[model samples]
Target: MLYDLNIAWSPSTSAAELERTLRFSAALGYNVVALNHTITPPVPPQVANPLPKFPPSPAGPASSSSTTPDQTPNKQPKLPTVLHRATLVLNDPSAYHRLPQLGSSYDVVAVRPTTEREFQGACLNLNLTDASLISLDLAQRFPFHFRPKPCMAAVNRGLRFEVCYAQGLSSSVPGDAANDARARAAFIGNVVELVRATRGRGIVISSGARGALALRAPADVVNLLALWGLGSEKGMEGLGVLPRGVVVNEGIKRSGFRGVVDIVGTAEREKGEREDKAVGKGKAAAGEAAKEKQEKGVDNNDKNGNGENKRKIGEEEDGGGGGPEGDDNKPMSKRQAKKMKAAIRKAQNAEAKTT
Candidate 1:
C-alpha cells in the first residue's frame, strides 16, 4: 500500500519518545526501523533552520534548546554513535537473558549489541539455540530476513537481512565511488544470485542508519541501485515494491545461484548498451539544449515572456526582408529579436550611450 518510505532520526530524541515513535511507525505501516541513538532535541519554532551545523562552537553553548546529552554543563557531549555488531548469547550470557525483552519491543530486532568484535570483517552469522531453533523450525513461519551491510554478502536458503549502507553511495565513502565499481557490481550480482538460490524465503534490506541524515531517500536508493547495473525490476521485487511482478515471476524460471548470476551478467550487458545509447543521445540533446538556453536567459525569461518584443519586432518589420520599422535597426534573424531587445534594454540600463 505504501510505495514511498523514509527513516527519520532526531539526534537529541529521548528514548521514551523514540519508543513511542517506533510504536507509531509500526502502526503506520513502517515495516523497518533503521536504528540509531536517541537524540532529544529542543523545541524550535517553525521556519527556522532545523539541521545541525559544523564547527561545534567556540563558546560551546549554541542553542537555547535543551538536549539530553547537552544537559551536563561541565562535559561536552560526544556525538552519539551506534554500531551494528554481533552479540552472541553464549559469548555474552547477560545479553541472552535479556534478548526476548529487547527483541519483542522493537520492530526490527537484531541479535547484536554495542560491541566491537567481528564488526568489520564478515557477514553477521545469526545463530539461534535449540529454543530459538524451535521457533525457526516451526511448521508455519513468517519469513524473517537477516540482511547485513553491503560488506557481508547474502546467504542462500534462509531469512536474509541485507545490510546495506544508507549514506555512502552519495559521498566519498566506501559504498560510493571509492568502492571498486566492478567488484561492487559483482557483489550486487551475487546478492541477487543468493535470493534466487534461496528461493522465496527472505530478502530484507536493512539500513544501518547512525545519524539523522544517514538515511537515504527512496529515489536516491533507486539511483544508487541502478548504478550497480543491478536489475531495477528484481531489486524492486526483492524490496517487495514490484509493481508488475516482473522480476518475481521472472525469478521462478531460473534455478539456483548460477542461473541468477547468469541473468545478472546478462542484465549488466544490456544495461551497458542502454547507457551507451543514452549517453550518445544525451550529448546531442545537451548540445541542442545549451544552444537554446544560451539564446534564452537563465531564468523564466524565454518561455513566458510577454512576446511584446516579438510582437513589436513583427509590427516594425516591413515583411519584405527589411528590419523593424525603426531608424537604426540591425538586420537580425527572428531568434535574435529577443537578444536584440535584451541588449537594447541592457544599453538603456547602462545609460552610458543615449539613443
Candidate 2:
C-alpha cells in the first residue's frame, strides 16, 4: 500500500483544510497518511506531561459497512487509514531522555537533528528514534558534508532516513523570486547529500506536505527521488516497502512480544497441555527405570549360582553373539567370528586383571 507518512497537522489548522488535504492525498492513491505534529525542542518547562493530543482524521470515521449515497452497486473505492505521528526537532543532546516516552504516544516517532551534535547523538545513542529527518528548511540545520558513518549506522539499527520534498516546493525565503529559487536549490542539494550518505538503503521519500496543494502524486514523488540520484526500483521501495517496514516495526516495538508469538489457546487449555506433557514424561521415565531394574536383578540371580535363568556359557560361546536371525543359528562370517573371539579374550583378560 502507498503511504505519505508526513502531513503537518496542528490544532490551529482548520478542519476544512485538513479534510481537503486528506481527500486530495487519497485521490493521488495514498492508502495511508500520517498527521504529523512537529515539536521544536529546548522543550518548554510548561509543556504538558504527555505530548499534545493527536489531530482528528481528515474525513472522520469511514462507513464501510454500506454504500455511500453516490455509490453504484458495483463501484466503490476504499478509504485511507489515518495515523498519528510526531516529529521532534532536537537542538541539544539533553532532549534524548524524552524520546522513549514520546515514541510510545504516537504511531511513529521521528527526530529532526538540527545540529551536528544532535545528529551524532541520534546515530550513536538515540536508539529510541524510528526516523531521522534532515530539516534543512529550519533556521538551525546540519552541514551538507556530513559523513556516511552515522547515516549508515542509523540504517543498521532499523531507523529510516526521511527526505521531506514538500519543503523545497514550498520555500518561504523572504525575498524576490531569485531568493526563492536559491532556497529551493539549497533544499534539493541537502536532499541529494542525505540520499547519498544513506546509499538509498533506508531512505523514505515523504511529501511532508502540509496542505492539498503541497501534496504530489506518488509517481511524481518517485520521479523526484530519481532526480535525487536513487534508482527506479529503490525509489519505489522508498515509497512503499521501506515505509511499510518502518510502520510494522514501530507497531511491534510498541505492542509487547506476544504480538509476534503464535500462542493461540485459552489460559486453562495451555496449562492443561503443559501438565499433561509433564505427566506422560514422568510415566515413561518410571517404566524405563523399572525395566532396567528387573534386568539387573535377573542377571544378579543367574550369577549367584542359580542355573535356572542363565544359559550354558559353552553352548552360547561358538560365535553365538546376538544377531538379526536370533532363534535360528546361522553361520557367522570369518571376520565376525574373529572379532567375537577377540572381544571374549579381552573380557577374560579384564576379569583376570580385576581378580
Candidate 3:
C-alpha cells in the first residue's frame, strides 16, 4: 500500500478542512496517511495525543434498495486508513529524553532537527528514542551540508529521512513570489545533496501538506524526486516500501518487548500445544504396548514349561539343587567343569585311604 507518513496537523486546524484534505489524498491513491502534529520544545508534563479520531467514510456499497430523491448526487469520498503521528522539533539535544513518552502516545514518532549537532544526534543516537523518521525542513539554507556518514548511519539504524514536497511547493507568506522561488531553489539543491549523501537509499517522500491542493499523486511525486536526483525505483520505494517499514517498525516498538520480541498469536500457541499433547499420547501408548508385550512374553515362557527348566538350571548353578545330576544339568565353562571333576577325584582318593 502507498503511504504518506507526514500530513501537517495542528490544534487550530478545522475538522472540515482536514477531512477535505484526507479525502483528496485518498482520491490521489494514497492508501494510508498519517496526521502529524508538530511539537516544539518544553513539552507538556502530561503528554497526550490531541488528534481527533475521524469516523469511517460512508462510501461503501448502498445498503438500501429504495433511494430518496433528496439524496445528493455527489457521495462522500472514501477515506484512506488514517494514523496519528507526532513530530518533535529538536532544537536542543537535551529535549530528547521525552521521545519515549511521545512515542508511546502516537502511532508514529518522528523528529525534526534544526541544527547540525541535533541532526547528528537524531541520526545516530536516537535508536532508543522509538523515533523512526528524521524529518528536516530542506527549504532553508544551513551552514552544514548533508554528509553521507550521518545520513547513511541513520538509514542503517532503521531510520528514514522525510522530504516534504509541500515546503517547495509554496511560500510561508502569501503573495510573495520571490520567497516562493527562493524556497523552491533551496529545496531542490538540498534534495540533490541529500540524495547524493545517502545515495537515495532511505528517502521517504511525503506531502507534509496542510491542505488538499499541495497533495500530489504517487506517480507525480516519484517523477518529481527523479528530477531532484533520486531514481524512479527508489522514489517509488520511498512512497510504498520505506514508509511502510517505518510504520511497521513504529508499531513493533509500541507492542513488542523492548522492540525486540513479539508475542505469538493465540492460534499458533494453541496449535503448538496440541502437537505436543499428540506426541506425548503417542509415546505413552508405545510404552504401554512394550510393557504389555514383555509381560506376555514372561507368561508364555511359564505356560510352555520353559520357565521351570530355567529356574532349575539357575538353582543348580548356585549349588542349591539336591539332585545327583545337578552338576551335569548346570551350565558351566569348560575349565570350571574340569576343576570340579578333579576335586571330586581327590576327595574320593582321600576317603578310600582314610577308610
TM-score leader = 3
Steric clashes per prediction: 18, 0, 0
Cα lDDT for residue 309, candidate 1: 65
Better of 1 and 2 by TM-score: 2
* Candidate 3 segments whose C-alpha is farther than 4 A from its true place: 56-74, 268-355
After best superposition, candidate 2 residue 154: deviation in angstroms? 1.3
**Weakest 10 consecutive residues, lDDT, candidate 2?**
63-72
On the 0 to 100 scale, the lDDT of residue 289 in model 2 is: 100
Candidate 3 achieves a global lDDT of: 0.84
The CA root-mean-square deviation of candidate 3, after full C-alpha superposition on the true structure, stands at: 8.0
lDDT of 1 by residue, 113-185 (tens): 2222322111334332101110111111113332344223323322233425442223324455545454444
- How far does residue 287 in candidate 1 sit from its true spot (Å)? 84
lDDT of 2 by residue, 101-217 (tens): 665567777888777788777777776434433333421234646579988987887677776788777564544677667667877777777778888788887887778898988
lDDT of 3 by residue, 98-206 (tens): 8888986788889999999999888889874368899999989978999999899989888899999999999878889999999999999999999999999999999
Worst 10 residues of 3 by lDDT: 60-69
